[model samples]
Target: MNESYKIISSSILFWFSQKKWFVYSILISIFLLNLNTPLGLTVPAYHSLIILLLVFMLVTFEPIPFPAIALLTLVLQVVLGVAPPNVVASSFMNDAVLFVMGSLMFAIAIVHQGLDIRLAKLIIKIFGKSKRMFLAGLMTISAVLSSFLGEHTVIAIMLPIGLSVIKNIDTQQADGKNAVLLTLFSIAYGTIIGSIGTPSGGARNVIMINYLQEFSNVSIDYWKWMKHAYPILMIQLVVAYFVLQFTFPSSLNNIKMRGFKKNVVKIDVKKNINHLFSCLIIIGIVSSWFAFNDIYGLGIIALAGALTFMIFGMISWEEINKNTNWGVILLFAATISLGFQINETGASSWLVLKFNELLATFPSNSMDVSWSIMAVLSGLTANFFTSSATVSLIGPLAIELHPTDISFALSSAIASGFSFLTVISSPTAMIIYSTGLVSTKIFFKVGILMFCISIIILYLMSQFYWVML
Candidate 1:
């Protein structure tokens, strides 16, 4: 018996050293802590935050897999007794999560039709034989396409094209491969820049919007989202371009471009005109969302436009299905449910109370102090949790701390989007890590630098663009 105990203790210690072990530990801890506590809706909310942090910590920074983290979360949630089977089960069916699924299907349609490739070729033709012009065109196209279709779809549709462009580098140069890497940076950064501009741009943005409306009362519709997001996106893109260009100048030396040898196929006339119709659909959806619905509920309009797309045969079910990432959807659902448990158990409230008490020692202006802490902590927390879960858990608390400075809270929320210390910080970090292009240390070095720059820029942007002068 003593030997068995020794072996089990060693195994538990070993598990913590591994990635998913700590995650499961936290999940179980939350459940056990809340099992007897009088937590309300907040119980699940706490679980959400804790679980998200663990999952991202593993996915981006550790070699542990995403699906495995998710499975561990599920099992721990069950064994710890934080929630009943039905409540845990229902998290999988959120409307916001479903919309994401539907959008994916729509995105796949565009890819399936060979429309994305044809469009890239058109872009290649437009840049007028200049490599710089061609790179700019790719960024522009990626941004526009990602805003409606979602970032993953945009990345999937365009990544190969970017690589192909790299392959096409003129053979006359000895280091043609280096030339492509520079252009690829443009593609990667531009895709990241565009991803924040719209709901469909990324999963977390949509999830954040839904949580904003559902939990808080801040309603930013499609048009309103564009109002603030477009400005940030444009600046971010230009900055990203200059940063990459300066940071990796060797990546762009002129070369004899190669490989786009296939004859350019013009999109059929019917689909050519379909672009105009798609434009109308986009415009109408934005206008209608603003004109109709309460501030907290504009998603129905996105759903409506999606329906229009389907009914009109602009994109088919198969296309949408192909684009959706059910794994991500499931992950979001599970985390949100956990967040609910956190809230209900009063764990979040208790944590906030303790934090606020600690903040009483700071002599600075409460608003400034609160926002500054939020900006930093949100980023740190996100290394362990997702941005959406970060927002869901901390956003409301930030607002509560400084209700008059709602913009400050918003700044913190946006700042939380920067998570870079660990690979699990954000979706982009996670997805890109999956591609195996760079090492963990490479990710850490670049990610930390970007995180620092983002903090400064995010603070300045919040002040200049959205907050007080």
Candidate 2:
């Protein structure tokens, strides 16, 4: 009896240890729900805020599967009278969610096309001349490709090339280790910096665009978004090169350029017409996004691209189904659904009013101050949480903060791309972390500097450059 009792107690303790955050989230949510609704806020709005708190804790801790968190979000909205069943269901799936699904499918298809081999050869010919040149090249190429192909996809392609370059290097010495770390960080940071350049760059961008259109009735087409964000991307590429150069100083002076080329496989696109054909399909999809996105929606255009890839037999359905992250899609849809309700129930507006009260305490209540705060908050939140979730949950509050000034919405969206602070902040960061070369301590150390620089650059661009356009 004593032995059995000890075993039962140990099992209970083990379960509690693993599930403590889950219990805390529910307990705190229940405690908040019991409080009286604040002044100037409806009961439904108050309840929605409680749900948001619950979501933040659950996502940050991830005590349960993301799909579970997502399902709970949907169920809670209906259960707490935050919105009706139909309303909740309507918000659960929208163009933004479709875009996320299609983008994931498209990424898997693009990876299957073997363009990375061709890209490797091209990168070697162009940028493999020297160590500094190679680092700059990786960042520039990654930024340019990621701006259109999405950071996750571009990283998937670029990481292999970066790894190949550093694979043969001896890491026992300081400089060799620096070379390996620099190459990887360049690819990761470049992918992140470029993810804000266009609407297709990241799901967070699309999420913000959806919020802007839905709440403010403002429409920003693909080219228009590029025009606004591309300049900042360009500046970041240059600044990031210098920042990374300073942070990870390496001299591959002894290493020959031939060594870099020998590491990557030689594959010419001309030898394979299918590779060229795949490129044409991608171009057609991008062209459609630029010309017809307003009519068809970005989500539909993205799906069309994935379908086109399928029709041509570039990638199999089985491949896409296996590679696509369904749980992430469900989580995005659920968060978006909650964001919609937050806006619909007046929670975002009420939060904005409270923000305004705080702003009033400041001496200068300029749009600049408000914009800066929003951008910083977005960046900080995004570092801890997923970028898409950050925008999905915060986009409404940003739009409600300054409905007339689109800069608030734009800056917040762009700032969320500063996913440099943590390993799990973005897929690109996680990709590099998986390599086992860059440690978590280095991530935090280098990330602090880059994050600061990015915020400063964003502020300058928003103040001067964004206004001219």
Candidate 3:
């Protein structure tokens, strides 16, 4: 009997230990729900904020699976009277969510066609003569591809290339190790900087676009987004190239080309036809996004791309389904729904009021001061939380901050791409860390430098450059 009691006690303790955050979140929610609603905020708005807090905890600690958290977010909206069932359901799925789904499917189709290998070989052909040129070429190509293909997709493709280059190098020596680190970081950072170049580059950009249209009635098409953002991407690529060089000083001037050559398969015409066709489909889709996105919407156009890929037998539905992270899609939809409710219930405006009050104490309402605060907060939050989540939560508040100045919205979205501070911050960072060769200490050190520089660049652009546009 005593043994049985100890076993049961131990099992209970283990469960508590594993689910402590979950328990804490629920307890806090209950406590907050019982408290009097704050001044200047409606009950529903206050409750929505409470749900938002719960989501941050659950997402950060991850004591529950993402699907469960997603379901809870939806359920809380209806149960806590945050929104009606129909309203919640409608907001749960929209163009922003559709864009995310379509992009993920498109990425799967693009990656499965082995185009990444072709692109990797192309990089070698162009930049193999010099180490600096090779790194710059790798980063530049990665940025351009990820600008349209999405950062995670580009990273998946480029990581192997980066790895193959450093595989034969003797890492026991300092220069060799630095060479490896530099190559891997170049690919990761390239994808990151590139993710802000176009609307489809990252889900966060789409979320911001969606909020802008929904709340502010402002429409920014694909090309317009690229116009506002591509210059920043170009400048960031140059800065990041130098940052990586300085952060990881390495001399691979005498490295051979055999490693890259060995990794790339010989191209045959018959086989290469499929590659060419795949490229055409991507081009068609991007063109559609540029031309008809205002009419058909980015989501439908993106989905059409995936549909075309399937029709041509480039990839199977089973493969796309298996590869997609449905939970993330669901969670994103929930956060977006919550964002709508926050705006609908005036929580976002309330936030803007408080934010402005905080800034009012500073004596200067210059664009730089206000813009810097939003950028820093957005960047720091993005580095800790996922970028999409940061935008879903923060986008509405940003738009409300300066209803006339779209630069606030644009800068907030752009700054969220500064995901250099942590491994879990972005998929590119996580992919590099998964190799187990990168030191967290070194990664953090470089990330801090990059984050600060990125903020400065963004501030300058917003003040001098973005105004021109």
Choose the strongest candidate by lDDT: 3
What digit string (tens of lDDT, one per residue) describes model 1 on residues 82-164? 67777677754565665555555545544554555556667777873877777777777777766655665677767766666
Candidate 1 — what's its lDDT?
Answer: 0.61
Total clashes, candidate 3? 0
123-233 in candidate 3: lDDT tens per residue? 878986787888899899999999988988899888888887788788888888888888988888899999999999999999999999999999899988998899888
Off by over 4 Å in 2: 1-8, 254-271
lDDT digits (tens) for residues 45-136 of candidate 2: 99999999999999999989999999999999999999999999999998899999989998888888868777877876898776688778
Candidate models: Cα lDDT each: 0.61, 0.88, 0.89
Worst 10 residues of 1 by lDDT: 255-264
How many clashes in each structure? Answer: 42, 0, 0
lDDT of 2 at 265: 52
Q: How close is candidate 2 to the true structure, as a TM-score?
A: 0.96
Model 1 regions more than 4 Å off:
1-95, 168-178, 251-323, 380-386, 392-396, 403-405, 419-444
TM-score, one value per model: 0.75, 0.96, 0.97
Candidate 3 residue 28 C-alpha distance from true site, Å: 1.5
